[model samples]
Target chain A: MRDGKDDAAPRARRRFLKLAGLGTAASGAALLAGSGAAKAAAPAATEAAKGYRVTDHVRRVYDLARF
Target chain B: MIAPEDQGRAYLYRLLARLLAAAPDAATLGLLRGLGGDGSPVGGDLQGLAGAAATAGPGALEREYHDLFIGVGRGELVPFGSWYLAGFLHEKPLAHLRRDLGTLGLGRTAGTKEPEDHVASLCEAMALLIEGKGDLGAQKAFFERHLEGWAPAFFADLERARAARFYAAVGRLGARLMTLERDGFAFVEGVAA
Candidate 1:
């Protein structure tokens, strides 16, 4: 009575939940670590709100442009 | 790994984009007025921003934005790369930019009427590229292809526009930032050579 298709859904769900839990734990630990984590995330959080990536190309561009 | 200075640079680009995207509301003006500055010319421009915000009479900022960027016919400034590069709006430059945007997996925000080559939009794109984990070579190529062609002249025009008051300060800030970027890029190119 075991179906691989049925098993796959639950397995994926379980894996997703596990990863979510790990992310929450990591953020909780980050909060406990200090203000540095929050400061570091500020720009990223703002960028995420705007809904796009400036990407690593900007860094390379900046590096290339440097005198 | 992202460098902290690069992060700051990206933030500045986004800030400039937003400021140029629309007329600042009272809340936005308040925020600008509260911003502290260093002793640089850019810093002085920020101080000028605060002064302009403080003096923004009712409907003045909106009228200014309209006159400068969105008049009944055409605004004082075109703010589009195509116009600057190919002597017209919606030309080959814009088509090339669209292709580049597609390659970069970027697109205009939904319902936006302006072309992809608007200066504000371009600044936002640059900021997104910097923040989004894109490769350095792509960034350089994009800048050389799109921005390096005409942005500095645009800012200089902005600095002298008769309609410019608050925007003159913005022009100054933009010019300073552009210079810094140009120098930085030139230095890197020199080193590579």
Candidate 2:
């Protein structure tokens, strides 16, 4: 049951996403290739293991939002 | 294994998180200017962003960002999930999100006063989930609990906000992506059911 549902569900979801332009050159991969934005936020698990540290990008956001 | 298509989703989420986190610097703007998209709605919004980035100047962009997100007291739009869902900052929604994040082995970086439910943080969290830190079930649960309720409305508001220029494009793209994710998840659920 798990294997069957996983196969059908992911395929259907992937098809839907593709139709909606996700992961396509128009929407995802090509557009993000040169941008450093993708690396701006460290994953929570990684950050947790390494100790809590916000990147400069995230720090800047905090600074901007400070009242 | 993470699929290439899922990588795109992570990339989109990270880009949105970055943009919402702060105004774009010169390098970011340059990247945005070079972005190309196909004819889909999401693609059209990307094109719109590229156009906006091409024409935007640093000074004006700074002012626009400030006006839209971080004015003297508060900006025109509050980008926190708590505010959107609970009519205030640091409300129950934030507490719930914090509890959820802890369960996922995630926590806010020390010394950051912003709540976990800030739009940027939520987007970043979603990116992490998609990037393989969390399973599909986790991603679905996170989106449904924290973002699905209010993020679409926030993005729609950002698109039409008076001070939005480049960010209007960001907003449009965000709105479209959220819709796609919501529908995509539903499709999966329907199949599973």
Candidate 3:
């Protein structure tokens, strides 16, 4: 029962995001690049680390938060 | 096939995770001070955060963070999902989340004392999901299960917490993002249905 609505959902979501001031070039660049403080939470290393994985990003966040 | 909007979303989550994880260092604060926003509600919150960042120092922020999240006994607010959802820490909700995380190939990092349900950890998990570790369906499910039940209330509480100053802005931004995320996920479900 896929319809035009299905095709339109993502586009509509994007428009809603744009109207909310997200997806802008400047803001996105500032957040993604300029705010280099927080590293991207990648699943690669965590997945490979141990059968039990702790995400490096999460670990680093903890390390930084430590007083 | 991650979209630009999604990247922005992931970064926002990452930013929140970082701030909630700990007070920002001077370098992070400088970066925050340079941020700009538009007329949208999220934009306004970003502006508020920028203003707070501009005025705040690391030592003060660290103290404020401690008062708000890590007091001598317990902070003004406990930022754990289990605490919010079950009225205690290390409850069934956490157990459920741990099972889900295992399914997703994620786990608590060794040596970390905080439960996996801590707000920062959850935000980081969401960021990872958005970055491609999980698809839209998975993201929606995880968010609804873990965050939707109580995160908004937690943010509202954080905004009003006595120790909140810089974090008040964070609370506002978090509350706003949670609303947007809920709506966004609903949009996906509406289309899928």
Candidate 4:
């Protein structure tokens, strides 16, 4: 797992994770990718707590989720 | 790597910045030199030291930056995702990450040429995700698959890199975050598994 290679305990574990819901096979992640620098950042200290603006891929995932 | 989904949180950025900047002696150790703070070993370490090579006095730090990050040849750690993950640099991880980005509705800025795997970029992404700046589930997935695996090792090297001084602290901070992320993810997995 740490080596990024597949082994027994971890590999099997990872496989199980995939079999479960966590092993989400990511599709094309390039859709909304943007330069993070220009994206307006919510002021660090602000109380409003604005979001960092997610990509459409995330929205898709959210749509898929039963949660 | 603290669950990239949570990276958008201000706490994450502050932790990262603190990791980058040696937690000034006071906050770190509790020994306040002028204030009589924690007084840990790191507390008094960097005080006598100079600035970061890239942005030192009279642009010394900038010079160091050229030396460290923007040298004509190559920089210290090669802060790219491909380099870190694939070892040879620009391998499947980068392609995978890019694909993930596309699906997520995120786009790379036209101006900055650095690949998506840059540490700053990763951290920025996480920070955005954390503040609910993006979809929590999507951000979490991005962070879990790509970063949680490799970043800790990268930060470990950064801390111990021969040229490390100021960035040594950055390394430590990163190392700590790595621990947090690893354990945190494991905990989450523990539940799902």
Against the true structure, whose TM-score is highest? 2
> lDDT: which candidate is best?
2
Point out where model 1 deviates above 4 Å. Answer: A1-67, B110-113, B190-193
DockQ, structure candidate 4: 0.03
lDDT of 4 by residue, A21-61 (tens): 12121101111112233234333311111122212212322
- For lDDT, candidate 3 versus 4, the one ahead is 3
* TM per candidate: 0.70, 0.84, 0.83, 0.54
lDDT accuracy of residue B9 in candidate 3? 76
Q: For residues B125-162, what per-residue lDDT tens digits would candidate 2 score against the true structure?
A: 88888766687777887888999999999999999999
**Alpha carbon lDDT at B6, candidate 3:** 71
Q: How would you encode candidate 3's per-residue C-alpha lDDT over B94-157 as one tens digit per residue? A: 9999998888877866565557887877887887787667877788888998999999999999
Instruction: Give the distance in Å from residue B32's predicted Cα in candidate 1 to where it truly belongs.
Output: 0.4
Judge candidate 3 against the unseen true structure and give its global Cα lDDT, from 0 to 1. 0.73
Name the regions of candidate 4 deviating beyond 4 angstroms. Answer: A1-39, A42-67, B1-9, B14-58, B133-139, B190-193
Report the Cα lDDT for residue B136, model 3.
75
Clashes of 1: 23
Candidate order by DockQ, decreasing, is 2, 3, 4, 1
Name the candidate, 2 or 4, with the larger lDDT value.
2
| Residue B147, candidate 2: C-alpha displacement in angstroms | 0.4
Whichever of 2 and 3 has more DockQ, that candidate is 2
Report the TM-score of the second chain of model 1 against its true counterpart.
Answer: 0.90
Model 3, residue B32: displacement in angstroms?
0.8
Query: Considering TM-score, which of the candidate structures 1 and 4 is the better prediction for this target?
Result: 1
lDDT of 4 at B24: 33
| i-RMSD of all predictions | 17.9, 5.7, 7.1, 17.6
